[model samples]
Target: MWDTVLIVDWSGGNDRGASPKKDAIWTGVARAGQAEDPVYHRNRQLAEAWIIQFLTDEHAAGRRVLAGFDFAFGYPAGFGRVLTGSDDPFAIWDWFAAHVQDSPKANNRFDLAGQINARFPGIGPFWGNGLARDIPDLPRKGLARHGHGIAEKRAAEQQAKGAFAVWQLSGAGAVGSQVIMGLPVLARLRQRFGADLAVWPFEPLTPPIALVEVWPSLIAKTIAATCPPGAIKDAHQVRVLAQAISALAPEDLARMLDAPGGTAEGAILGLGHVALLEQAARAPVLRNDCFALPQGVHWTPVDQALAHLRQHLPPVAGVQPQPLAAAAGQYLAQDVTALRAHPPSPNAAVDGYGFAGPAGTGAQRLTLVQGRSAAGQPYDGTIRAGQAIRILTGADLPDGVDTVVMQEDVQATDTAITFQGPLKRGANARAAGEDMAAGQIIARQGRRLTPADLGMCAAAGIGQLLVYRPLRVGILSTGDELRDPGSTIAQGQIFDANRPMLAALVHQWGHQAVDLGRAPDNRSILRGMLDQAAATCDVILTSGGASAGDEDHMSALLAGTGSLALWRVAMKPGRPLAMGLWGGRPVLGLPGNPVAAMVCALVFAHPALALMAGGDWPEPQGFTLPAAFAKTKKAGRREYLRARIRDGKAEVFASEGSGRVSGLAWAEGLVMLPDAAMTITPGDPVTYLPFGSFR
Candidate 1:
């Protein structure tokens, strides 16, 4: 049997009406076994009788119910009016309060007090006597807190006594106003009711509601009344409706709901429809919360940790560059000034003959003067008619010379030159400040320095540039049974490969890696090395000694020093990872097993380096590849399998032990298998994460 959900609208309206325009009866019937759906008529006597009878019936049935409503059960009488003006209003609580005030017991002191006290137990004195007193200037600062406290208390009473899960949704108006007025009340209820009182804002046009609200009238009719099993024909129809509603896109729905005339009531109905459809569709419900590490917990989700760090880290300030050599391959420090401190005197761009003419395009011949002018030198005397001077690129054009015929264009005849084409004023001439202007942003902040950028800065008379300092990473490995490569192992000792692998990884990320000598299986010596590294390096990474075994002393040392942030992450192979502060510096402890250490480092170290380098961390790169062979897995934790690419598909490599170094050599990348997915057939798309050049 499925759980029952009740959607109650306490506003003044009847489910059925007689007149075509006035009669508003819902003809549709709710699926069998669901809770009662009631539209509380504004008629106080009738509504009170109906509510009492409904509660009596529910109490006799002994079944728990989850109720969703459009109004805040704990809202102060005038709170809604304050947010949404009373003229364009849909104030449920206000109507109820007015109805209560005008009831037959209006003259009865006990009845009036009970009505007010039901929602605000101790506030009758303030409303009735405080303003009437001579000292009416009493502080009202406690009113808001008092109101919130009462709302929470009432919501708790509803949940504990009635076994209810109450959901309060907002209507159309100022969204900010609704949130401000509604959230505090809902939050108070949630604190006491726990999951039983799940409160989320319902935007009618959002995906979740659209998916469920497709047939709003039908769902609303069904929820508004009780019906027998045969009246609705098939119960699965409800499920189908729910599934379809749940599948609608949220962005599209939000657009629709945000349109004019979209009201809180409309949004509530939309959400109710969605919920009903989901129930009928038999869709799975997902419970999600912001990622966080519990007290004393070790390994945390990499995304969560990175997000927290970003919030706490201060903004990086811009700095000027040091020198040209240091600025090589770096972004420009600032905008470059123009090549010359002041504008250059007018010059010619080409090395050719200069001449004086009528300053227009139609020109025929020019006599060449024997004098020559090279760059940085100019012909001092003015040119005569039909006369020209030999000039080089960057040399000032003599006065009265408005054009330069290219050397190729001039046909030399001893001391004279004949022009084949028309010559125009200002043609082939380099104007002052032609390349760049002074004080322009020649280089922007945060841009990577390129050859063109460097050249431009140098041309602008800048010799140095400022850049972010490189991140420093220290790599260390621990194990008495480890030996460096090329050194013969004695007895049970194995080769130390983690240090080199990690160092290479750090360098690939553009960080400076300092290789700290290996530590034997001694806690005191390991602690001292870690302390020293933490004092100098931005991040300290060590392999081995993370587990809780006798040889696993890294966790202990970290705990004794500063503070241990996390000791273990809920990941495979790298489950016993450690993260903490040592002597005010961050430390990451990886498992001693070669493959495990490398994978963990990729998952964590790469992101840390990017953050420290003043760059946004890149998303984990994933590729789709077919499974080389069939594999079975437990349906809980994510799994990564080492595989090689063959024929554009992933081929699983045999021998995947965490301690096996040969596995790393054979595999090109790792394949991520999502949790709750047990088997994947050949040709099924699986995400491949590359570790080498393939990335």
Candidate 2:
């Protein structure tokens, strides 16, 4: 039996500027000893990388990995003949792989669908595109107005109700885009992994990584009522499915995978639907398919293949010396040791009379000494027997004198003093090195010097210190639709919010904020801007044009000219992060949506810049507060809800969208939801992080 089961609720929507927590693609994983929580992915490119990395890691640990994707793996049998001149289901996969254009920001699904529709007798067996994407003949909505387009339902869809036509590319119930977009990725994965991957029903399950089609709706109805309110509907569905599979008997799971079936688009996995799956899996493998795994080949898991990638991450930047006066908030590069012992020599801790041997105890009269010991003006001579010196606080303790009696505790007359209270030896005197000994470590490297820490350094005779220099951060925004905030707005243009906001944030974090301004949609200009930023700044930040869309020139530039180190992180309000090196300097590409841009800047870029500036990475510190709202979250990805503390509880925004900047503006802080599959309720303690902490 597989030790790890992964389920993905695939999306065909434009996820370029989506919130990570609620994107079109939601992935849930269930490990033998782990809790179920789904992780969200906005950019399919990054998602692919993460999936490959995850599977590689899991297999390296010797755990069996079973993954499911929610989409039609193949079209209805006859349609494959019409589309690819063959009944072999894999022909369509090969066709898509040969033609589909996919990137971090965009895809060619609509255009390819139009071309496919043109080849058919009439309007699409494929249809639907927004007004902006209107093709020559396809209708924007509803059924095909004309054409001999085939509408035969796939066998799996016929088994399940409310299934959409594979011909519809836009609107509700449309799986056309998904098929066109998802198949290409699958083909790539199949080709990349070769014998290591197997597509269920189409190929024999001899490999370690098995790709299966899943219809969440098939088992979702059974657990709909059991799911808690406010929980993400899709997340709950995938979680329940993974849970059911993990709870099944090993023999039962094997039987389900071996189930027989007729048409592709694949079988839905569920313990309740085991009979159907077993029949499908056991069905004779389609030998006629253009794509098939070779028999008798061993496969490597994704986890094992990518294991070394994690260990060879880029190192943090070098350190620089900074003066003590300019070192506030800067991380120390070296340890600070005390120059001399605290209270160099014994001194009076109180204003009193210093005498020999405590004046022999109890009410003894002592003659006055020749000198008085005051702060900064110590008595040079030693006190003789039966003599006392008048001393003030912080004055050096004279030789032969070990105790001090406050004036209030003794009666003083001309040239003499009479003790009224008992005096102990060394009373009211601060000893040398009592607070800190010489050569003691005052602060260690990587510690951000605080006010109290600075005071300590000053007292230890440290007038200067070594620290990391401030990081020079350059902010840039792309897209022709973005204009300066105060500029006149034309039709289809919005004021740019990311550049100014990120620049201010960079400054607030004590880094040099270099405004590279906005780059137009032209690739060459964008490349020029990036080069300039790289020349002057240590790190570069940009929003928009990071997706795979054709107009997304920033991504094209990075993918073509620079090295892309990271593409996506499993986080909410921030998912699409294009990280790489440009001209030997690091760059971070944020989503175009303002709220997402801000969230990603804080969560991902801030810490990275800090590290490059020779500072220790800071983790968000949170406090537990009662939840005023209820929610359900998937495991594997972290999310932050724009929320505020109200009536001593955390309340999330009424609307949740990456574009909702007003909600972020209204929020005082963020409610941190961990990467765990669980439900939260009112009055439950949730971790809350204030903006002040991050800023």
Candidate 3:
């Protein structure tokens, strides 16, 4: 129900009495259809001040916000009673508010944790403050002589596998200090916002500013691969969480906030969005129900879903066998074993004379035999001790012959051959099974056969191969402003480029591209075409009707007859990438802008289609080169600028608009910008991915 979603990656380290420097606190923002770059915060105080002011400004503008903090908002059920003299978590929040102290330079998290631990009678429910040298209650490690605090983990933490115990107050991966330092900020937020803000699980979630507990680890596995290497861990975490939360639909978000027993660690959203969609699509086969899912969630991550699909989705089910010549570009459904050894038997490697025994000394001459050995015609008789047989290249070696000298180094006459050079035992001869052995696995199941693979199978005597059928792709273009190229020109109408471009790309990728034709803004026509495409094609691709414009019909169509998996991915020039399933077939809705549509198709749709076609997704190949241009980019959204390599440097297009189709035509590749706030200097290193790699 919110218009803006913010994810906070908080830290509890003592900024050493100064503002945090790096790997500290990070915050990311995602609006209804736009994801803002993440902002770095040096300390909790600054972060709190910014959040308060930002939320105030947004609320003043009548915008609703869903803000999630990455820290426990409450303690375990019974611990709340011991800490605040009540079983209610809100009471503990109030207690922390009154007891904790924070500033840009320092915080009393360790002292407060020690104070709270003293009430419980043990070393911990709170321990580990390496910064506190003289603290009696909170030791750096191990229990004190008289310490015995409870070691209870919150239900949400336990449900989130690999989650650290909340009692571990210090050391690596410990969130206890964060809980103590962060709750005070939440308490202040609640006080300032009052009824405007609602803490999930503890308060009614109907407020304009909802505060929910979040664990980035819940969605980390799904997005980790997409994140750039050597990126700041905290910044990356918040960005991923923001993207995941922004991608969730309304119903799915509600189910996550409504999860049971999330009062302590807070309700983790974006962890169940995938599950809700899976449930709606009746694709629960990938869900493992044994683990405790937050409330109605039976979800799996995108990587997990892809893996499951790759494993269980049989190679085009019941595909027919095809000849080796027709197997190129298709996935092999069965393993191919070598039928016979290569070179069937030992053969000569060159046209020469075969000698019975090795040449004892240099300049040795031998009398030639009447029989000759040529390819496909071997002599029946063996050579005598002082005689040699004439052998041609690829001819099988006769009995009593072990080596052959090159014809160029020998003198030959009718019925006689002479070699004047010493011969090695096995020189110039190909041994049986040298290239391939009998019963060897030349190709395994699920391998996409290439031309070389087909030739290898042919050499191994495999005439036919069992392979998956070709993937069928249906392409569509939607919008009244879009008209087929070469049609009569009309006012305010642009020739359609997305359909033909996408169709050609699909074909180049070895799929059968079916042109579903151009669709107007009419819902009936769009729905009919979508229905037909879903029923007949393996995947449906469309452009121009995915946004919120009045003419946008893809969203409504998916909402009515299908389930939209994700909307508005956190990407520049291509935020409006809508993905879902219609009639059990996958649909990738790209943007209408030619440049954005092409980039989205390559970066997202391309890999997705590969996975659907029972083939491994191709990783984007790139090389590092110095940038020949300079620009400032935002963090949290990935951008691919039309660029090319010139003078050994990467150069970008002059204009950065997604509608500039000429940029794609003018550039040979793209310059990839990671999701971060940074200034690119002319000599700085940039990643360049050639367009040919995608093709």
Best lDDT goes to which candidate?
3
Ranking by lDDT: 3, 2, 1
Give the Cα error of residue 675 in candidate 3, in Å.
Answer: 3.0
RMSD of each: 21.2, 29.6, 19.5
Q: Which of 2 and 3 is the better model by TM-score?
A: 3
Candidate 3 has which clashing residue pairs, if any? 122-147, 122-148, 122-149, 123-147, 123-148
Clashes of each: 31, 30, 5
Local accuracy by lDDT, each model: 0.51, 0.72, 0.74
Query: Candidate 1, overall lDDT?
Result: 0.51
Candidate 2 worst ten-residue window by lDDT: 283-292
lDDT, residue 268, model 3: 52
**What is the per-residue lDDT of model 2 for residues 201-304, given as tens digits with 9 covering 90 to 100?**
77777788888887766654454765788777777767766655543434446666775755554665543453333222221211111111234423312222
Q: Kindly give the stretch of ten consecutive residues in candidate 1 with the minimal lDDT sum.
A: 204-213
Which segments of model 2 are wrong by more than 4 Å? 1-321, 356-365, 406-408, 417-425
Question: Whose lDDT is higher: candidate 2's or candidate 3's?
Answer: 3
lDDT of 3 by residue, 360-470 (tens): 666777788787899999989877787888899999999878788888988778766666656667778888889899999988866778999988888788898866557
lDDT of 1 by residue, 259-353 (tens): 33422322232332233232223322111111124666444544455565554432121133357666653333233445453235668779788
